[model samples]
Target: MKDDNLGDSLEYTTGAEAMGDGLSRARTSFGKQPVLGILALVASMALSIGIIGLLDAELFATWVTFFVVICVPVHIVISMAWELNYPSFSRKLKQPLKGAFFMALMLLVAAAIAVTVHYAQPIHAGPPTPFVLMYVIFCVLVTFWFVIVWNCWPLSSLLDNRLLLGLGILAVAYGGGYGLFTLLFDFDAMSAAPFYSAAMDPGGAFPAFHVLAYSVTTVSVVFFCLLFDFWPITLFPILRAQPLMGLVSTIYILGLSAAVYWMGVEWLDMEPVKLMVNVSIGFLFGSLIPLIMFEGKLFGNLRQPWKGIAQCAVAVIAAVTLPSIYWELAPLVSGPLNSGAPGYQYEFWMASALLAMTFPIMVVVGKFLDFWPLRFAPIR
Candidate 1:
């Protein structure tokens, strides 16, 4: 009887192991197909954009201008949350659908609150309550749809794994930095108030400029240059080191602002002090916040602190100088500007210049900085 029982127990254990292995293999197979995920994402974004365009073309244009800027951060936040709490929702609900629904619901609630808080006026305008309610509802629905699409889409190929840490960094740096700026500069009256009014006025040039500058220059710098591949990660090796990675990246970003100022003065014929202040503010939103959030993933693999700092300094100098040179030469290829054009020429020029700045810097960094001496230079 004892021998028979032992045999049965071993059989049961083997069967369980086989089942677990099969499940793991199935998940791996599903996760590995990134093409399918990208297709899904494209389809979802198209559908969402189409719906919004039908409702309000101007607002749709605003979103299109900042599509990457808005989507990447939201995707990072959601993906991080999903990764950290993986399988809990799936197991508890006995399916992936329930888990997805739960995530969508949470995001919807949060989005509604944020939209209402940001948009709702304290003084009652005519039928303000109904308008606020409708806006909140719309925001919630959009957020819910976004969460669903993100979860269903496989973004592992496009984004880094340590996104949670990145999200935390953004929340602290951009959120905190913006708050500080507002307090110091009376941002609400000077910028925010005007921005809010302009955003509502679809026909206004200020609206276009506001969205273009914020999205293209400030937002794109962080999203593409730092988070995406537009700026080579090799430019800043300290991004991978521990303890001081965030601090160092922040400082390097601020220093890069000075370089941008120099370019604005030399190439764009802009005022030095104004450029310095503007670029510094831009850095707070663009490079500094994003680098601290996304690039700090390098810290986990870092071993040497001093070498990281040295590499970071070199990166700052290279980032500044290379981009400055590009800006100076960009006008040769740029066609004549139509001053009477409906859109703001300066906004377009700035966006073009910033985009141009990324390519040359990326080429230089990727070609020269990826070699062994630099590759192993980060020490940790």
Candidate 2:
């Protein structure tokens, strides 16, 4: 969801000529770029709000689920693994336009998943909500274990082609996701279509919401690590290498998220789903502005922990403030959503809009296209 190993190549300049015509990484002929960055963020925000206005809140959440289920994996493939290796895949359309094509493709695949989940219910013999709510969302957390935590290990070695590698990784993601879901999540908590079904329940060790909350919070923990440039762990050289770093970091993060979850839920009496949406994913979504939209350059020069701390501060501020605004607007925009009270919970529409919809739009604009419409140019 953030830029990694990507930047426009720039030459170094020096000495007497440094101030002359020589170009530098920090030098630029691109004029008035911050304005364009602001505009891109604005466009994404407007699109997210417009979508909420257009759909019923429940319907909005359904599609949001669809996007989370498919879009993140697709992004890992095309953007992260493939690194958009084939612009010709879209007939070599110029950038920004080409990026739009890629985004559309991810959406199309998500829609396909939505259709299958909806229709397969006849065969599965239960409501589709369980699949969407449990397997799909957890698939996100599971896949991150592969791509991010595992660094796409064995598979990255075994699969050479980008398409094949992506498919393999996604397979592992969903396969592992299903395994974890079956192993841990107690569907009894939601089996009666928001009511408990103790008889039909899978009777797993952890409540579905508990596992779900922890999984998502774990991802946010990873983002915090990334914000620190994989710090503390990255501080150690031997453990800084691939699988070891991933393994150690994953263990550390899982425990960290667990502690955070435990304190928030047990000590503070916060709801799991609410905490996931408002704190975990919401913080990541808010960090997107500084991290993605501005290319993280705003803090690029800062040293570890301090930089991470500063960004976390910004994320906390956004997490606290934006959701309140979204909540106020949700009823008016999405039309009569419940206030997320038990038995009538529909409040996640706004949070989902911020995380699933707005976040991706920002990624498309800022990361994938290098903030297109605002080129990085040489100093004149």
Q: Pick the candidate with the highest lDDT.
A: 2
Compute the lDDT of residue 280 as modeled in candidate 1: 30
The 10 consecutive residues of candidate 2 with the worst lDDT sum are: 7-16
Off by over 4 Å in 2: 1-36, 87-92, 115-127, 191-202, 374-380
**What is the lDDT for 208 in model 1?**
29
Clashing pairs in 2: none
Question: How high a TM-score does candidate 2 get?
Answer: 0.82
Give Cα-based local distance difference scores for all models: 0.31, 0.64
Worst 10 residues of 1 by lDDT: 2-11
**Candidate 1 CA-lDDT value:** 0.31
Local lDDT at 274 for model 1? 34
TM-score of each: 0.39, 0.82
Q: Give a tens-digit lDDT track for model 2, residues 243-354.
A: 6876898789989988989888899898887788877877766666556665555565688888888767876776787667767777788777665545335545654677
Q: List the residue pairs that clash in candidate 1.
A: 240-298, 240-299, 302-380, 303-380
Task: Report the C-alpha displacement of residue 259, candidate 2, in angstroms.
Answer: 1.6
Best by TM-score: 2
